[model samples]
Target chain A: MTVAPMLSVSGLAVDYQLSSGALFRKHRSLNAVADVSFDIAPGETLGLVGESGSGKTTVGRAVLRRISAAKGTIVFDGEDITRLKGERLRRLRSRMQIVLQDPYTSLNPRMTVADIIAEPLIVHGLASSAEETRVVVAELLERVGLPRDAADRYPHSFSGGQRQRIGIARALALKPSLIVADEPVSALDVSVRAQVVNLMQDLQRDLDISYLFIAHDLAIVRHISHRVAIMYAGRIVEIAPRAAIYNRPIHPYTEALLSAVPIANPKLQRVRRRIVHPGEAVDIANPPSGCRFHPRCPLATERCRNEAPHLLRKAAEHFAACWNRDA
Target chain B: MTSPLLEIDNLHVCFDTRAGTVQALRGVSLSLAPGETLGIVGESGSGKSVTAQAVMGLIDVPGRISEGEVRWQGRPLAGRNADRDARPVWGKEITMVFQNPMTSLNPLMTVGSQISEVIELHLGLSRPAARRRAAELLSSVGISGAERRLDQYPHEFSGGMRQRVMIAMGIACEPKLLIADEPTTALDVTIQAQILELMAELQEKMGLAIVLITHDLGIVAGLCHRVAVMYAGQIVETGLVDAIFENPLHPYTQGLIRSTPGLDAEEERLTAIEGAPPGLLQPPAGCSFLPRCPIGDKGCEAPQAMRIFETGMVACRKAGVPAWSEAL
Candidate 1:
């Protein structure tokens, strides 16, 4: 049929060892992400969303092999990338790139904008001559809303939003088939946020690039993503099309999260209920038996407390973890 | 009814800096009745935080409220009250939850002890009793393992947990009002929801009013009962939340709302308010927003002034800018 998806993950598990593997005593391990699986089709964007420490970042890092996966398979371009090491891993990194959250921190202050955008090309030998590199770098900077003259200026001179444009230009330097953007515009001012997001959407359309967009803001993710995945603790609590997740959430956590997002207009707030879960997030080191969300779940039952649930199909192409999905 | 809860009349806060006097808040007047959430919405440096700081009597030194009267519960506050040994009544009568909880909290102290200290000193609870109550308060704000977490340092908790701890500490003494200054700026969206829910629940249980100082319109839309739109150290528009949103009066308020793209909108291009906010060091002369005003009439050129209309208020020089209109 049509060639396999650009990026695919099955049974992906990422856990951090609190201590080393030396001691006789059993060291604790925090399961940052467990048994997570998703696919990013070519030219489509999948938004991964969760609160702080939800392990969404870990997933992005794992897919790029930045961190060692405890278990699972990562298939990129129909080849198993999970076991690739050294030279092979380095080669694969060019096709799948990352655009970090803070543009100020990601770009080297010492380097000029020209050098910053040309990094991936020079490293991967995509450009041979300085003149050829200059032409490519100029084109990228312009595409991301920066002027061609910006190539000579240092990162410090640019505003917060302009710096982010530089970061996007750098990510596209290698013409990466897939990109992992983690909170790309969250730190930016409200006025500039939209422009950057729109630019990204434009880049995706023109270049046929797929994105694994990870962020905390739903309103932002809703605009760009084809599918949305909500994370809790370290698991994908719900995953579905954008419309299904935002308008008709199946998981209680998802519902609460959707309700919690503040609307732009001040008037329609009465319809919003202040959902208060009077318990804390479960410890990742020793998550609750069965459902990790059981402690704070409003409709928790005996089965929910002890019987672990998986991604059960609640609707077409929609999956939820709740035992009582109907509820 | 009895002199309102806190009456801030003709308040003018300014800074006498090396450059010149920065007019932060200019002749701003607002009185809050107990159990009313007044949302002061504005962009950065709109003097929302300064107003909250003024209420707490914690305005930074060298920054003076050049003119105004601050009356708390019908008594003039000059660092004294009915009792002779009264502090500014800040942190006790009107506690505040700041934007970044990590910086606000004492990193050296345990979370539990820090919260307990407030209850012990203000509410006159015993150390043991205060610790017990602290655990309850922590649990009440959606913090898990409340007792165990009490002994943990601020760095040990996540961002959301840290904010919840600040809320617990702010409400420890049952302050009539809680000033949450951008409480969710550091948090992600889902955690922000949880925090808002917790804050609303606590307000209901404790019968506390909240003055939410934030730049996020979404929080203002979903939370505040009333809002005071601020610009260049002045309240340009003050009205009920619905009235303000449905019918924004001033050009600045309209610009902010238009700039934000709606979640459900099927549109492509978003309207952006061009240019940056004006520097307060040399405030704009005739109509601060005149440079960017889309509806600036001839009156805009001749010193912008506040106009009190029926629904709310507007500070525009436009002749026909109504307080409540679908024109926006």
Candidate 2:
């Protein structure tokens, strides 16, 4: 009775090569992501929450084959697309799309709305003629709650929220089954952010599309995601269902991140005890030998400092990589 | 409030752009007492930052305070020769912390020089004395290895550490008031919490008053004693943090509260305000939020003024009426 996942990524790792000097030509490889594993079920969102440079965006890019992964397998719809390239990769791109964070710079100012949304269809050869593409573009505009007349205007004429809608319309033009939305609503205003989040949820219900939602804002992630994964340094520290992750997080990093977010209620915020962890995330190139978070963890023991723990099952659907948390 | 420390009376700021005159602030008034934290929460183009800049006498040509005055300790600080008058207390008594620390700190100068410059200029300390005081200030802000870290440039420090250095420089002169505009917006949540904690500790130790301008309601709720909600360059509501959060009288305030998704939100959908804020150029004569107000009626077409209500000051024609009960 369990449906197969739309996208599955296991043991994914990405590395960036850094050249120290032009004369010496000494090269060093920085491991940005390591041993990351997750699955996105059909029509379900897997929210990837992490701070800046935690490799959340690297995971998203690796899944789409935009960047080559140094290790691990990325299976899309039961097909191993880890090494896809040439015509095959071009065809696979039609099945998945991406929406960037900044709407102001994502769209081209010179192109009209119709051209911006229709470029994908034309590039992929999805439609037959200009007339046919126009029909699909109008339908997409309506689907994303924009007027058809907007097709004639440029991106500079639209507001931030409206430009985001245009970007969403362009992403939907390919009828993508999976969307890699990287901080999609982080650059938006507070009131307009909800409208886009609601629209994404509604589209998910109607189209049965899965999403890899990458963001740093936990509250928005909790609102839109069905499953959540907390990442630190370059690994998945914890993964669980939304309620389980928020209510009973097993990893110390997850607990600290949750407690640090300020609540909106004044009365509740006054009495809330914040677990302010010291220092920022470790440098990816020179991570610690044991747990990457041991330096800042309050409950770090000798075992946690010497041995790196593998992800162990804590509940039916909860998994955490910590030596102290017992099942 | 025991003789307000800073009082802004009917402030109006305008910018003369190529297109036309843009009214950035329209008759905005606020009062702050000593050692109090007032949170100014609003979206972009809400004139919150402009109010802070005006209070600091930072507004320049092409954008002038067309009307009203800003008084500091019952002394006029905004008018002709305002800059000459404000120069005495501008940096020594009133300081500011910007959003992005990376851009605010000079890349060429070492962290020690930046902190020492402020101390030497204000406190009349010698070079070596100021440098020693700089290291002490850095340690007070929780930066480890303060002496070594002081010699390093800003590029060597992490984002969180750079922000801490900024705070160290901000408090080097023992300023009486601090104007922070989205101070923690560029930091992560954990680092933001640490910075907010540092600011609170500094306030308690120095008895410093703060004017915090940000777009996040959660930060305001946590750190501020009072809150002012601004919209389209006007103060829609101002009251105690508890009263505003519990029972918001203005429709804009109510909408903002409902729109913000809480950490423990049970509702599936957030109540979004439909339209975007109006353009500043040639804004409507009536309430700026009238077009987006849920319970807007014919009476809202006329300009509304801030009036005292049961809980606080609201600028709505139907402040405490029951008509909004169903609409909200």
Candidate 3:
């Protein structure tokens, strides 16, 4: 018997309507994310790795229902929340929380730490009185490794790592089954970044919460994620177990991305042959006819350029979308 | 060693803010040889950028280089008359590429004109000649259809392309030194590789010395010949990149390396430094990293100075001791 996925997204697509200030010009829509799919098991992390404009963040927002999906269905637990509306959507939101990229801007400056964490509890009607909310806030602060006295202080007093911890505490106040953490440690210092990443990992083990860890840093993703998905031009080119994605990436884009990451050791970095993929990511507004990455892919053939490849299983629990997977 | 191209001696920079005087840099010293690449690795508020600014004479009002001498090719470059003396060499000999290319390039001006402006100002070239050189420079940085793209504004370019444009302008006058302050921090990994490759190519072609200031250790290891690890306002360690990575004497450097998640390393819990960097306004008296150092003791309470090691210089009391290696 297989355990059910806590969150499942299928054929997810997000479109942004572009407005040209002309009287009779036709309205244009940019498909930010197209045909993306993934699943996050309870207590598992699905690292979504991509460059800028790859729609990784869009996938996270669409998963959280913060942004309406243009196409596809998002199933939370056993229910299809693709078209969840009104009170039903608000209630479902508590089960799914979002941790934004920049902690400095995510939290309100005027609100105290207790108020920030308690706001979610109060909104969900989980806490009865002010005393109850305070107790829960203190517990959350401790869980995130922040001191209990930190509950009374404002966001301005906390460091970047501490501020991120507060954000995590807020996300956890609702006992969310899944948290869409979009570049959670990108803005933090290197030393502080590790602390936050470790804290997030610790929380996962303790709470059994699933995380859609969206980040551009491949190494950090490898550390925190049980599985990794490589996205390019708003589509997942590869998805596999952590080792497979890093060690035996089938997709050409994945290989290029892995090679591009600079290793800390000079001896290895000097010896490693980097596969520099020429040209930028394809324009999402007007993508290529078949494969969006064909323009820059080194191993692109006539078939790759003419035919769009869907995710095909290459190994157990390893899937790659490439016509020339063997290459 | 080849008559250092840039030398910063006992540099001390401070910022007078409304709250208090923030000691940004305290007795920071470094020397870089001609055509060498030095990577300044430090976190936010570690004075790496301030050191770059001091060398370039770019420190504005409210922030002053209180104590130190900036020497450019054996000539004093920082003092009361530093600005006027350094003005001539600013773009012609020394150029800087900032972190955010979006804000670094003027949005109003066409990229071609922006590049031309630097060439015209420094090289005394005519408008037409500068424009021609600008297109060539753009092409040199790997931008396709450079002439046509040069006519476009900053907004027309992507983040990576804008950075390329910035690089084109930086090398337009064939500067002897280029200081890139977190140049690739804002770029994607692939794009960052492209930029790093471009910088390396430019350095090889122009024989330009580069001071790459960033928080990422990986980039430094790959690109830089030497590395300097800064904490608070001091250079805790400075050495050959290989030695520093292989055997970091300073506890902070060890912690930083261990904390960074290696791409190839197996999934393991990162060993994070417990506390945050001390506040600059009222920094700790002896060692700023004392609060976070794993092997720090009562000896670390006293002031520490850069001590000579087998491979590099480390500013820690227990640097060469057995306890430091045992702790790691």
TM-score quality measure for candidate 2: 0.98
lDDT, residue A269, model 1: 61
> Candidate 3, which segments miss by more than 4 Å at Cα?
B80-83, B320-328
Q: What is the TM-score of each candidate against the true structure?
A: 0.84, 0.98, 0.97
- For candidate 3, give the DockQ: 0.83
Docking class of 3: high
**Candidate 1 chain B worst ten-residue window by lDDT:** B78-87
* lDDT of the structure predicted as candidate 3: 0.90
Interface RMSD of 1: 2.1
**TM-score of predicted chain B, candidate 1:** 0.92
Predicted complex 1: CAPRI docking category? acceptable
Q: What local lDDT score does residue A216 receive in model 2, on the 0 to 100 scale?
A: 95
State the lDDT of candidate 3 residue by residue for B216-318, as single tens digits. Answer: 9989988999999999999999999999999888888888888899978764688788889999999898988888776788888888978998788999988
lDDT of 2: 0.90
Identify the superior model by TM-score, candidate 1 or candidate 2. Answer: 2
In the order shown, the candidates' DockQ scores are 0.42, 0.81, 0.83
Model 3 chain B worst lDDT window (10 residues): B319-328
Better DockQ candidate (1, 2): 2
* Interface RMSD list for the candidates: 2.1, 0.7, 0.8
